[model samples]
Target: MKPIPLQRRPRGKKPLWREYAEALAVALVLALVIRTFVVQAFKIPSESMLETLLVGDHLLASKFAYGIKLPFTDTYLYKGDEPARGDIIIFRYPNDPSVDYIKRIIGVPGDVIEVRDKQLYRNGQPVRESYIRHTDPTGREPLRDNYAPVTVPPGKYFVMGDNRDNSLDSRFWGFVDKSAIKAKAWRIYWSWGGLDDIRWSRIGKKLL
Candidate 1:
């Protein structure tokens, strides 16, 4: 007797729903990785940055500019170059780590910083800050107008906002530690001036 022949069953394709779910999961993972290690989107919430970064401006910050800090931790996987003076950076607020602040690097490690009559002096030389904006011309707050010189300790950065007169910065709080720095502000991706008013001109502008 001949052996009975067996018929093979056809294999069915994967469900469309499963494929879509897998694709969505992959996209979400990629976005999270990018946000944690590469670049992240942030929106300006106050007038602290003013003309440089207006309120309602959405910007992207390069997380790897200084180093790749482990997400939710201060430790870095690979330490990058030190932040340079005048480089705009995003860091955790020294006084309150829960909040984030963006400002220009005014003084780096070992640099002497002082504000004399609203003029900034670094390392005994006057800094030429063409980007600085003064909303109040006659305001003479002691710390705002004439700050006593202080040497920035190692691993700390002295930062200040472009809107000098209105900004509460290193002068008021303290220096930002290197480990607290998260990223560098790269460019303005989107901006809205007011209700239904998109700031087209400010879009794509690079932040210093």
Candidate 2:
């Protein structure tokens, strides 16, 4: 008599630990990419910008507004639109490459920017600033008239700290180039006046 064949046992599923590890690794890599090419977080380090942006104000930056950039190259794969005056911009300081400074674009390419007394004149016309707090105005930069007829060179930008008085800006150093810009600030996402304290009302504040 022939012996009956034995039934084969089924194989058990692989351990869940392997799957969890793989998922975690992928998540971390994705986060890094997003941080580099997409939105980035920035915190104001000084009060150079007062009412517009205060110290410790956290903000979101849109890198794609300009164009996409390679991970570690100075070359621009895609040339994007140029910046305009009155836009708040984030750019690498021309004199100091290691520093990233944020300021408003007061003058664009081929625009004449100058200040008389404590008032500002753009291209022979005055810029009406209603947001500034006139309490103890810092006054205009000294010898500002000497720098008049400043035609913004192509591919360059003029930046200024909102505080106006204490800021080291284009008036002091020089113009910021198109390549130096990192992103355009959009809004105040979160704020902390002190420890364990968060100001919720400041969230979603649109930047000018």
Candidate 3:
């Protein structure tokens, strides 16, 4: 009797489970890369930005706006353009690196920053800020309303919140180093005041 022909297994074909796992792994890697170097999302936990960005606002920040940083570290892999004044940035809190904060860049290196009676002055010139919100105009706080003029050091940036009356920013902590900046606020993807208050007007709004 002739022996049955030997069955030949398919060559270079992966098992279905393996294929799925490989796909999942690739997806995870891509997501990590994107989050680390491309863009990231953050929720507004406080009214630091006020009219510009409200609490409960979910926004996307461009991680590559300043440069590409090494994954899991503040070191830059390929240094690119630096952040400029008026750019809203998310950065590691200088006082506590474990915490992150968001604020607008008010003074670049060598810039003189001061606040007199709640009016911001850069380089001894009053800045025109149409986005700032002052809830208490008559209130007087030493660092909040009247700050001594100080020149920003090299590689350091002075940042502050639009809600000048209630924000704890560079004026309170210290200058945020360039390396601490992680991303630049790009656009608002979602916003809501509460369960019953979805801010439709704020959604998709671009941050200046």
CA deviation > 4 Å runs, candidate 3? 1-8, 72-77
Q: What's the lDDT for candidate 1?
A: 0.91
- Candidates in order: C-alpha RMSD to true structure: 2.3, 3.6, 3.2
Off by over 4 Å in 1: 1-9, 72-76
Name the top TM-score candidate: 1
The global C-alpha lDDT for each of the candidates, from Candidate 1 onward, is 0.91, 0.80, 0.92
TM-score of each: 0.92, 0.84, 0.90
Model 2 TM: 0.84
> Could you give candidate 1's per-residue lDDT for residues 104-147 as a string of tens digits?
99999999999998999999999998899998888788998899
Per-residue lDDT over 14-112 for candidate 3, one digit per residue giving the tens place of the 0 to 100 score = 889999999999999999899988999999999888988888999999988888866667677877678999999999998888988999999999999
| Model 2 lDDT-worst window of ten | 132-141
As a TM-score, model 3 comes out at: 0.90
Q: Distance from true position, residue 16, model 3, in Å?
A: 3.3
- Give the Å error, residue 57, model 3: 0.5
Candidate 2 per-residue C-alpha lDDT over 1-208 given as tens digits, one digit per residue, 9 for 90 to 100: 9999998898887689988998999999998887877888999888767778877789998887788778778766666656877788888889988998999998988888887765678899988876543333644446432355577889899887776666778888889998899998888998877787777877889898
Query: Which sequence of candidate numbers ranks them by TM-score, best first?
Result: 1, 3, 2
